[model samples]
Target: MVSYYHFQRMNKALPDPGSWDEYFETFLAGNVVWGSWFDHVKGWWKKKDSHPILYLFYEDMRKDPKREIRKIMEFLGKNLKEEILDKIVYNTSFDVMKRNPMTNYINEIKMNHNLSPFLRKGVVGDWKNQFTEAQNKQFNEYHEKNMADTSLDTHFRGLS
Candidate 1:
Protein backbone atom coordinates (compact mmCIF):
# COMPACT_ATOMS: atom_id res chain seq x y z
CA MET A 1 0.00 0.00 0.00
CA VAL A 2 2.85 2.37 0.84
CA SER A 3 4.45 1.64 -2.51
CA TYR A 4 1.14 2.08 -4.32
CA TYR A 5 0.55 5.48 -2.73
CA HIS A 6 4.15 6.51 -3.36
CA PHE A 7 3.92 5.67 -7.05
CA GLN A 8 0.50 7.27 -7.27
CA ARG A 9 1.92 10.53 -5.89
CA MET A 10 4.83 10.33 -8.32
CA ASN A 11 2.59 9.17 -11.13
CA LYS A 12 5.06 10.45 -13.71
CA ALA A 13 7.47 7.78 -12.56
CA LEU A 14 4.87 5.03 -12.93
CA PRO A 15 4.20 2.98 -16.05
CA ASP A 16 0.84 3.58 -17.70
CA PRO A 17 -2.20 2.24 -15.81
CA GLY A 18 -3.21 0.18 -18.85
CA SER A 19 -0.24 -2.10 -18.03
CA TRP A 20 -0.98 -2.18 -14.30
CA ASP A 21 -0.24 -5.87 -13.87
CA GLU A 22 3.22 -5.38 -15.32
CA TYR A 23 3.71 -2.28 -13.22
CA PHE A 24 2.68 -4.12 -10.04
CA GLU A 25 4.95 -7.04 -10.95
CA THR A 26 7.90 -4.72 -11.43
CA PHE A 27 7.13 -2.74 -8.26
CA LEU A 28 6.63 -5.81 -6.06
CA ALA A 29 9.67 -7.57 -7.54
CA GLY A 30 11.98 -4.62 -6.87
CA ASN A 31 14.99 -4.99 -4.57
CA VAL A 32 13.48 -2.53 -2.06
CA VAL A 33 10.41 -4.72 -1.52
CA TRP A 34 12.47 -7.93 -1.14
CA GLY A 35 14.96 -6.22 1.13
CA SER A 36 12.20 -4.92 3.39
CA TRP A 37 10.55 -8.33 3.51
CA PHE A 38 13.79 -10.04 4.44
CA ASP A 39 14.56 -7.47 7.08
CA HIS A 40 11.09 -7.86 8.59
CA VAL A 41 11.45 -11.64 8.68
CA LYS A 42 14.84 -11.36 10.32
CA GLY A 43 13.51 -8.97 12.92
CA TRP A 44 10.48 -11.13 13.59
CA TRP A 45 12.63 -14.19 14.25
CA LYS A 46 15.21 -12.33 16.31
CA LYS A 47 12.56 -10.76 18.54
CA LYS A 48 12.14 -13.95 20.60
CA ASP A 49 15.52 -14.02 22.38
CA SER A 50 16.84 -12.25 25.48
CA HIS A 51 18.68 -9.67 23.39
CA PRO A 52 15.76 -9.32 21.04
CA ILE A 53 14.81 -6.83 18.40
CA LEU A 54 12.16 -4.28 19.36
CA TYR A 55 9.52 -4.56 16.67
CA LEU A 56 7.02 -1.70 16.49
CA PHE A 57 4.39 -1.33 13.83
CA TYR A 58 3.57 2.11 12.48
CA GLU A 59 -0.16 1.47 12.76
CA ASP A 60 0.24 0.30 16.34
CA MET A 61 2.20 3.42 17.17
CA ARG A 62 -0.39 5.63 15.46
CA LYS A 63 -3.26 3.98 17.28
CA ASP A 64 -1.73 4.18 20.75
CA PRO A 65 1.48 6.14 20.87
CA LYS A 66 1.72 6.37 24.64
CA ARG A 67 1.50 2.61 24.98
CA GLU A 68 4.01 2.15 22.15
CA ILE A 69 6.44 4.54 23.78
CA ARG A 70 6.09 2.67 27.05
CA LYS A 71 6.97 -0.50 25.20
CA ILE A 72 9.99 1.19 23.71
CA MET A 73 11.06 2.44 27.11
CA GLU A 74 10.67 -1.03 28.55
CA PHE A 75 12.68 -2.51 25.68
CA LEU A 76 15.42 0.02 26.35
CA GLY A 77 15.28 -0.79 30.10
CA LYS A 78 14.44 2.77 30.94
CA ASN A 79 11.95 3.86 33.58
CA LEU A 80 11.37 7.41 32.55
CA LYS A 81 9.03 9.70 34.48
CA GLU A 82 5.40 9.82 33.40
CA GLU A 83 5.83 13.51 32.54
CA ILE A 84 8.74 12.72 30.27
CA LEU A 85 6.78 9.95 28.56
CA ASP A 86 3.86 12.28 27.98
CA LYS A 87 6.24 14.87 26.54
CA ILE A 88 7.72 12.30 24.18
CA VAL A 89 4.27 11.24 23.03
CA TYR A 90 3.22 14.85 22.43
CA ASN A 91 6.38 15.65 20.47
CA THR A 92 6.12 12.56 18.32
CA SER A 93 2.46 12.98 17.45
CA PHE A 94 1.82 13.23 13.69
CA ASP A 95 0.55 16.78 13.87
CA VAL A 96 3.63 17.91 15.81
CA MET A 97 6.04 15.83 13.76
CA LYS A 98 4.57 17.13 10.51
CA ARG A 99 5.27 20.67 11.61
CA ASN A 100 8.86 19.91 12.59
CA PRO A 101 11.14 20.76 9.65
CA MET A 102 13.63 18.02 10.57
CA THR A 103 10.94 15.33 10.51
CA ASN A 104 8.80 16.65 7.60
CA TYR A 105 11.56 17.13 4.94
CA ILE A 106 10.25 20.53 4.00
CA ASN A 107 13.43 21.73 2.23
CA GLU A 108 14.95 18.47 1.06
CA ILE A 109 12.99 18.16 -2.20
CA LYS A 110 12.32 20.36 -5.23
CA MET A 111 8.57 20.15 -5.64
CA ASN A 112 5.89 22.82 -5.36
CA HIS A 113 4.38 22.80 -1.84
CA ASN A 114 0.83 23.05 -3.15
CA LEU A 115 1.11 19.97 -5.36
CA SER A 116 3.62 17.88 -3.41
CA PRO A 117 3.49 18.06 0.35
CA PHE A 118 6.34 16.38 2.20
CA LEU A 119 3.80 15.18 4.75
CA ARG A 120 0.75 14.47 2.63
CA LYS A 121 -1.98 13.27 5.01
CA GLY A 122 -0.26 10.84 7.36
CA VAL A 123 -3.18 8.37 7.33
CA VAL A 124 -3.35 4.68 6.50
CA GLY A 125 -6.09 4.47 3.83
CA ASP A 126 -4.57 6.93 1.34
CA TRP A 127 -3.88 4.03 -1.05
CA LYS A 128 -7.64 3.50 -1.48
CA ASN A 129 -7.84 7.04 -2.79
CA GLN A 130 -5.19 6.45 -5.46
CA PHE A 131 -5.47 2.82 -6.54
CA THR A 132 -7.97 1.86 -9.24
CA GLU A 133 -10.02 -1.32 -8.79
CA ALA A 134 -7.99 -3.13 -11.46
CA GLN A 135 -4.70 -1.99 -9.94
CA ASN A 136 -5.76 -3.03 -6.43
CA LYS A 137 -6.86 -6.45 -7.65
CA GLN A 138 -3.61 -6.98 -9.55
CA PHE A 139 -1.56 -5.88 -6.54
CA ASN A 140 -3.45 -8.23 -4.20
CA GLU A 141 -3.01 -11.18 -6.56
CA TYR A 142 0.71 -10.47 -6.91
CA HIS A 143 1.07 -10.02 -3.15
CA GLU A 144 -0.71 -13.27 -2.29
CA LYS A 145 1.32 -15.21 -4.87
CA ASN A 146 4.65 -13.84 -3.67
CA MET A 147 3.88 -14.10 0.03
CA ALA A 148 2.28 -17.57 -0.14
CA ASP A 149 3.04 -20.08 2.68
CA THR A 150 5.10 -17.53 4.60
CA SER A 151 4.86 -17.43 8.42
CA LEU A 152 5.32 -13.70 8.33
CA ASP A 153 2.55 -12.00 10.31
CA THR A 154 1.84 -9.12 7.93
CA HIS A 155 -1.07 -7.84 10.09
CA PHE A 156 -1.87 -5.39 7.27
CA ARG A 157 -5.55 -6.22 6.84
CA GLY A 158 -5.89 -6.59 10.61
CA LEU A 159 -4.63 -3.05 11.03
CA SER A 160 -7.10 -1.78 8.42
Candidate 2:
Protein backbone atom coordinates (compact mmCIF):
# COMPACT_ATOMS: atom_id res chain seq x y z
CA MET A 1 0.00 0.00 0.00
CA VAL A 2 2.93 2.32 0.67
CA SER A 3 4.19 1.57 -2.82
CA TYR A 4 0.79 2.42 -4.25
CA TYR A 5 0.72 5.64 -2.21
CA HIS A 6 4.14 6.60 -3.52
CA PHE A 7 3.15 5.83 -7.07
CA GLN A 8 0.02 7.98 -6.82
CA ARG A 9 1.93 10.80 -5.17
CA MET A 10 4.74 10.67 -7.71
CA ASN A 11 2.30 10.72 -10.58
CA LYS A 12 0.32 13.60 -8.98
CA ALA A 13 -2.77 11.50 -9.45
CA LEU A 14 -4.13 11.91 -5.94
CA PRO A 15 -4.19 14.40 -3.11
CA ASP A 16 -1.45 13.95 -0.53
CA PRO A 17 -2.40 12.75 2.90
CA GLY A 18 -0.77 14.07 6.07
CA SER A 19 0.85 10.73 6.82
CA TRP A 20 0.86 7.03 5.98
CA ASP A 21 -1.81 6.44 8.60
CA GLU A 22 -4.13 8.88 6.87
CA TYR A 23 -3.66 7.13 3.55
CA PHE A 24 -4.14 3.78 5.20
CA GLU A 25 -7.37 4.92 6.81
CA THR A 26 -8.61 5.96 3.42
CA PHE A 27 -7.57 2.62 2.02
CA LEU A 28 -9.37 0.75 4.77
CA ALA A 29 -12.50 2.74 4.05
CA GLY A 30 -12.32 1.51 0.44
CA ASN A 31 -11.96 5.05 -0.87
CA VAL A 32 -8.97 4.09 -2.98
CA VAL A 33 -8.96 4.48 -6.71
CA TRP A 34 -9.81 0.84 -7.50
CA GLY A 35 -12.02 0.15 -4.45
CA SER A 36 -11.39 -2.48 -1.81
CA TRP A 37 -8.41 -4.70 -2.48
CA PHE A 38 -10.15 -7.75 -1.06
CA ASP A 39 -13.22 -7.19 -3.23
CA HIS A 40 -11.12 -6.80 -6.37
CA VAL A 41 -9.00 -9.86 -5.65
CA LYS A 42 -11.95 -12.00 -4.54
CA GLY A 43 -13.85 -11.09 -7.71
CA TRP A 44 -10.91 -12.26 -9.81
CA TRP A 45 -10.38 -15.34 -7.68
CA LYS A 46 -13.98 -16.39 -8.26
CA LYS A 47 -13.79 -16.31 -12.07
CA LYS A 48 -10.13 -17.29 -12.39
CA ASP A 49 -10.92 -20.89 -13.40
CA SER A 50 -13.66 -19.83 -15.81
CA HIS A 51 -11.51 -17.20 -17.51
CA PRO A 52 -7.97 -17.22 -18.92
CA ILE A 53 -6.77 -15.67 -15.67
CA LEU A 54 -3.49 -16.76 -14.18
CA TYR A 55 -3.24 -15.64 -10.59
CA LEU A 56 0.35 -15.17 -9.52
CA PHE A 57 1.50 -14.27 -6.04
CA TYR A 58 4.46 -11.98 -5.46
CA GLU A 59 5.80 -14.14 -2.65
CA ASP A 60 5.71 -17.23 -4.87
CA MET A 61 7.40 -15.37 -7.69
CA ARG A 62 10.11 -13.95 -5.42
CA LYS A 63 10.74 -17.34 -3.85
CA ASP A 64 11.31 -19.15 -7.18
CA PRO A 65 11.22 -16.81 -10.16
CA LYS A 66 12.46 -19.45 -12.58
CA ARG A 67 9.66 -21.79 -11.58
CA GLU A 68 7.15 -18.96 -11.85
CA ILE A 69 8.45 -18.05 -15.28
CA ARG A 70 8.07 -21.65 -16.40
CA LYS A 71 4.47 -21.56 -15.17
CA ILE A 72 3.91 -18.40 -17.19
CA MET A 73 5.49 -19.98 -20.24
CA GLU A 74 3.25 -23.01 -19.93
CA PHE A 75 0.22 -20.79 -19.38
CA LEU A 76 0.96 -19.01 -22.66
CA GLY A 77 1.61 -22.38 -24.36
CA LYS A 78 5.12 -21.27 -25.29
CA ASN A 79 8.07 -23.63 -25.43
CA LEU A 80 11.34 -21.79 -24.98
CA LYS A 81 14.83 -23.11 -24.35
CA GLU A 82 16.26 -23.18 -20.82
CA GLU A 83 18.79 -20.52 -21.86
CA ILE A 84 16.00 -18.14 -22.89
CA LEU A 85 14.20 -18.76 -19.61
CA ASP A 86 17.40 -17.92 -17.76
CA LYS A 87 17.67 -14.68 -19.73
CA ILE A 88 14.05 -13.81 -18.94
CA VAL A 89 14.65 -14.34 -15.22
CA TYR A 90 17.80 -12.22 -15.28
CA ASN A 91 16.23 -9.39 -17.29
CA THR A 92 13.15 -9.26 -15.06
CA SER A 93 15.10 -9.28 -11.79
CA PHE A 94 14.58 -6.31 -9.48
CA ASP A 95 18.01 -4.77 -10.00
CA VAL A 96 17.78 -5.18 -13.75
CA MET A 97 14.30 -3.60 -13.86
CA LYS A 98 15.38 -0.74 -11.59
CA ARG A 99 18.22 0.17 -13.95
CA ASN A 100 16.26 -0.27 -17.15
CA PRO A 101 14.30 2.89 -18.00
CA MET A 102 12.01 0.87 -20.24
CA THR A 103 10.92 -1.33 -17.34
CA ASN A 104 11.07 1.32 -14.61
CA TYR A 105 9.08 4.54 -14.64
CA ILE A 106 12.21 6.65 -14.89
CA ASN A 107 11.15 8.25 -18.16
CA GLU A 108 7.55 8.86 -17.14
CA ILE A 109 6.91 12.59 -17.37
CA LYS A 110 4.16 12.60 -14.71
CA MET A 111 6.17 10.71 -12.15
CA ASN A 112 8.76 12.40 -9.93
CA HIS A 113 11.35 9.71 -9.38
CA ASN A 114 13.13 12.10 -7.01
CA LEU A 115 10.32 11.62 -4.48
CA SER A 116 10.47 7.85 -4.70
CA PRO A 117 11.62 5.36 -7.30
CA PHE A 118 8.92 3.39 -9.06
CA LEU A 119 10.76 0.33 -7.84
CA ARG A 120 11.73 0.73 -4.23
CA LYS A 121 13.27 -1.90 -1.94
CA GLY A 122 11.96 -4.99 -3.73
CA VAL A 123 11.85 -7.23 -0.70
CA VAL A 124 9.11 -9.29 0.91
CA GLY A 125 7.56 -8.15 4.22
CA ASP A 126 8.74 -4.58 3.73
CA TRP A 127 5.40 -3.61 5.24
CA LYS A 128 6.83 -4.50 8.62
CA ASN A 129 8.86 -1.34 8.52
CA GLN A 130 5.91 0.84 7.64
CA PHE A 131 3.23 -0.44 10.03
CA THR A 132 3.32 0.21 13.75
CA GLU A 133 2.27 -2.50 16.17
CA ALA A 134 -1.13 -0.93 16.70
CA GLN A 135 -1.64 -0.41 13.00
CA ASN A 136 -0.48 -3.94 12.33
CA LYS A 137 -3.03 -5.38 14.71
CA GLN A 138 -5.77 -3.23 13.26
CA PHE A 139 -4.79 -4.15 9.74
CA ASN A 140 -4.67 -7.83 10.60
CA GLU A 141 -8.17 -7.69 12.04
CA TYR A 142 -9.44 -5.79 9.04
CA HIS A 143 -7.71 -8.19 6.69
CA GLU A 144 -9.18 -11.20 8.49
CA LYS A 145 -12.69 -9.82 8.26
CA ASN A 146 -12.35 -8.80 4.62
CA MET A 147 -10.74 -12.08 3.57
CA ALA A 148 -12.94 -14.41 5.64
CA ASP A 149 -14.79 -15.77 2.63
CA THR A 150 -11.77 -16.16 0.35
CA SER A 151 -8.99 -18.73 0.33
CA LEU A 152 -6.36 -16.18 -0.64
CA ASP A 153 -3.59 -16.06 1.93
CA THR A 154 -1.44 -12.97 1.84
CA HIS A 155 0.35 -13.97 5.05
CA PHE A 156 1.76 -17.22 3.73
CA ARG A 157 5.04 -18.17 5.39
CA GLY A 158 8.55 -17.19 4.19
CA LEU A 159 7.65 -13.54 3.71
CA SER A 160 10.94 -12.35 5.12
Name the top TM-score candidate: 2
Task: Give lDDT tens digits, candidate 2, residues 1-160.
Answer: 7677777677655566447888888888888887887788889888976899877878788899999999999999999999999999999998899899888877556677787788988898887788787877777888889889987777532223
Find the number of clashing residue pairs for candidate 1. Answer: 0
The global C-alpha lDDT for each of the candidates, from Candidate 1 onward, is 0.64, 0.80
Residue 128 in candidate 1, Cα distance off native in Å: 1.4
Across residues 1-160, which tens digit of lDDT does each residue of candidate 1 receive? 4544343444444333334444455555553433445345655565566667777777788889999999999998999999999999999998999899888765524433554566767786666665677667766676677666565565544212
> What C-alpha lDDT, on a 0 to 100 scale, does residue 18 get in candidate 1?
38
Estimate the TM-score of every prediction.
0.69, 0.91
Task: Identify the leading candidate in terms of lDDT.
Answer: 2
- In model 1, where do residues sit more than 4 Å from their true spots? 1-25, 31-51, 108-115, 158-160
